[model samples]
Target: MKYQFPENFWWGSAASGPQTEGAADVDGRKPSIWDYWYEIEPGRFFNGVGPKNTSNFYYQYKEDIALMKETGHNSFRTSIQWSRLIPDGIGEVNPKAVEFYNNVIDEMLKQGVEPFMNLYHFDMPLSMQEKGGFESREVIEAYVTFAETCFKLFGDRVKYWFTFNEPIVPVEAGYLYDMHYPNVVDFKRAAQVAFGTTLAHAKAVKAYHALNLDGKIGIILNLTPSYPRSQNPADLRAAHIADLFFNRSFLDPVTRGEFPSDLVEILRERDFLPNYEPEDLEIIKENTVDILGVNYYQPRRVKAKENMPHPDAPFMPEHLFDNYEMPFRKMNPYRGWEIYEQAIYDIAINLRDNYGNIPFFISENGMGVEGEERYRNSDGFIEDTYRIEFIESHLKWLHKAIAEGANCHGYHLWTFMDCWSWANAYKNRYGFVEVNLDENYKRTVKASGKWFKTLTSQNGF
Candidate 1:
């Protein structure tokens, strides 16, 4: 094989309980923020579809695990919905939820697929949100308790654990942009939420280690490399600030146990620093991650701010940098996201040189097409040659990075099957297996799925 990966490299895909498991209100599973938000404002989601109409993994884990093996997945990543497990967020456990997750894990093991369990994936219980979500120190402690409970319940069988997936997303989506629940658009509150989430992650890491479990615990971060349009000092500075806000804010603390000094100084100068006890800093400093999960989709093309906002306007990251559209850049026509394969290699090199060469993997990387059925052939399988090309191009760069000693361990696509995304809600299809929504959500392996099985069997393409 020309593009060979390391031996025993993890080849799988990732999904989340809230996104895949469809029993939103069944078996003691309470409403998550996604459910509550959809209830009040269904029009915000695509086609007015809500969280209730997911892929139904809750009722079909056995079949799903079988499909996972058929698609050549040696390992898989999925999150444990906090709302489903605890329901009330900080009290008695849900027996049904425990049984459901236990069965899912056991079935994966039975099928020879390793399970990489993540504790949280943007699925906050409604009760926790009512208590100020991650913004409140009380809620942070509650999240830690939930993490500890998960460890006690499922630690022995699950060898890979993650504290959170894309911890910065809620801070940006919910607090800054109003894309998620509680829709607050205050920069100060967003800063508080981000800080509190880091504190919660540290507490969870502390709790996991205190139990002396044999598993590795880490946090998944979506690290978009910031590329300046021009190397001018101003443009470079703008890119630096963008990186500080989006990437380094979570990456540095989880790996290095501290925030970037430049970011801290900038926030301090603006009087936008989040409220934190002195002890909180100690916890963050003491407990860092054991590994890392990097989810790279594209690079950020930025330039210096062209026109300043009104002096009295609310603060935002855009005030310091402006997004620049690089001419002739590759893009995913359906999703409107840039297709930058080399960004994966850039991220690996950055981690190798700057972040202490910590072991990491591509936790989430895949294309989301708007209408994939158009590519279906007469034989019923979607050809999806573009999807295969997308993965192949990215893997070539990843192979180069690993050959140069980048310390990358695995590559897991963003999803295993076509799942119901949060707000997009199946607007884009991104899976090797097609989920026929019109046909009782039937599962059919696509052309790319067959190709993947061969790739995994050979350990390369």
Candidate 2:
């Protein structure tokens, strides 16, 4: 093997409860924001599909865990839906949800696949959202309670626990971009949501540690390395601001226990800083993460702003920089994302050199194809050679990074099977296993799945 990993490296994939478990309103599971959003605006979803139209993981987890073993999984990560675990997001635990999660965790352990459980995956319970989601400090306390409940219930067997997955997504998508539910476009409000989320994360971390559990807790952040279009001072400044806003905003608080001073100055200058109690800073500073999960998909290529928004326009991150589209850059046509394989290495080196070489992993990385069914061969398997090449190229860069002493320990794909993606629904398939939704959510290992099995068996290609 040309690229062998360290012993006991985690080899698996990740999916979320809202995307995989289809019982949106069954077995005492209440509506999440996804469910509410779909109810009000069904057309917003792809092909009119909603949260209930998922892969049926709630009933098929046993079969899915067996599939994980077949695909060479030594570990797998999935989230516990807050609405399901505590139907209203606070107060009495749902017995059915408990039984379901307990069964899922035990089944994974029985099948030799370690479960890496995340507490939140962009699924805010509707009840919690009604009380202002992360914007309200009260909701933050509620979230802490939910986190503590999960820790008490399943923390014993699930050694890897994450407080939130891509915590910045809700701030950006729901508050600033209007891409998610409770859509609002206010930078000030977005900042508040972001700050509240970080506080919630820190509080949860503090709560977890107070229990003296024998496990690691962390947060999964989707890190996009920012690159300036040129060495010009203006371009460099633009790139720096972009990095500070997108990456360092959460990264610094979680890892370094402080926000970047420059980010603070920028927000302060605009009077956009979120309201924070004096003691909140103490909690944040005292409760940094134990591990980190890096979800790398693309890098941000930025340049100095070519055109500024009108004075009346609402303030936004783009006011500081413009996205640069390099000529002839590699592209994932299906997903409309730049396919920059080297960014993975850039992230590794950044963490290694700047972040004390903290132990981390590629928590979510994979390609999503628009029409994967077109690649199905006569043998009844999707010939997903592109996906295989995609993972291998990134893994080679990761291998080089590891050889250079990066603290990365694992590489889990974005998912283990084709699952529903919010809004996008199942339009882009991103699973090692091909799920035929037309055939009652049937599962078949794709060509990439077979290749992945071999890669894991050899520990590399």
Candidate 3:
């Protein structure tokens, strides 16, 4: 094979609890922020569909895992819902949730698939959210407890664990912007939320290490390389600041065990410092992730801002930089995100050169195209030629990175099947298997799925 991956490289896809599991009101599962937000305003969701109207993984996990095997998934990643596991996110463990999760794990293992479990995936229990979610110390403690419970319960069977998936999304969506629940546009609150989540991650890693479980714990971070529009000093500075806020804020503290000094200085100057205890810094410093999960989808290209922000306006990350769109750049027009496959290689090199060459994987990377159904071919499967090309291009760059000594171990797509997103709902589909919502959520393997089977069977394309 011209492009073969390392032996034992992970091959599969990822999906979160809230996005895939549809039993929003069953089996001792309480309301997550998504569920509660949907109840309050259903129209905010796509076609008025809520989390309850997902792919129904709660009932069809067995069938889905079988499909995963058929699609050449030697390993798979999914999150155990905090609300389902602990109805209140803090107290007694639900026996039903334990049974359900154990069954899922066993089934995957039975089908020769390694189960990678993530503790949290942006599904904060409403009870916890009522108490300020990640913005409050109480919530942070509750999250740490949740992580510990998961470790104690499933650590033996599930050897791979992640504390959180894209923890920065909540900071950006809920605190910085109004895309998610408890939407408050406050930079100070965003900082606090981000700080608390990272601390929670470190605390969870500490707890996992205490258990001495034969597993690795880490965090999934979306690393979008910040590209400057020009070589000008101001433009470079703008990109640097953007990276500081979005990438280094979580990457440094989680992996390097320290927040970026440049970012801390800016936060201090603006009085936007998070309310962190002195001991919390020590916890973060002492406990860093064992592995890293890099999720790359798009790059952030920015130019220096042409106009200064008005003093009266609320603080925003974009105030310092203007988004730049390079001419002749490939684009994912369906999602309105640029498609720069080379950014994946850059991320691998950056991690290898600067982050101690830590073992990592492509945790979440896939193309989300709208109107995928229109591509259904004579074989009754979506052709998805573009999706196949997207994966192949990214994998080519990934192979190049691996050849150069990047310690990336695997490539998992964004999802196992198309499922609900937070606000976008089912607007964009990113899956190897196309899920038919109208036909009792029937699963059909797309052309990409067939290609992936061959890729994994041969260890690469």
Provide the overall lDDT of each model, using Cα atoms, as 2-decimal numbers.
0.93, 0.94, 0.93
lDDT of 1 by residue, 1-461 (tens): 49999999999999999888998889998998999999999998989999995998998789989999999999999999999899999899999999999999999999999999999899999999999999887899999999999999999999899999999999999999989988889999999999999999999999999999999999999999999999999999999999999999999999999999999999999999999899999999999999999998889999999999889978899999999999999999888999999999999999999998999999999999988999999999999999899999999999999999899989999889999998789989999889998998899999988999999999998
Stretches of model 1 off by over 4 angstroms after superposition: none
* Candidate 3 Cα errors over 4 Å, as ranges: none
- The runs of at least 3 residues in candidate 2 whose Cα sits more than 4 Å from the true structure, single-residue gaps closed, are none
In candidate 1, position 108 carries an lDDT of 97
Error of 3 at 395 (Å): 0.6
- Model 2 pairs whose backbones collide: none
RMSD of 1: 0.8
State the weakest 10-residue window (summed lDDT) of model 3.
44-53
Error of 1 at 99 (Å): 0.6
- Please write out the lDDT profile of model 3 over residues 209-238, one tens digit for every residue: 999999999999999999999999999999
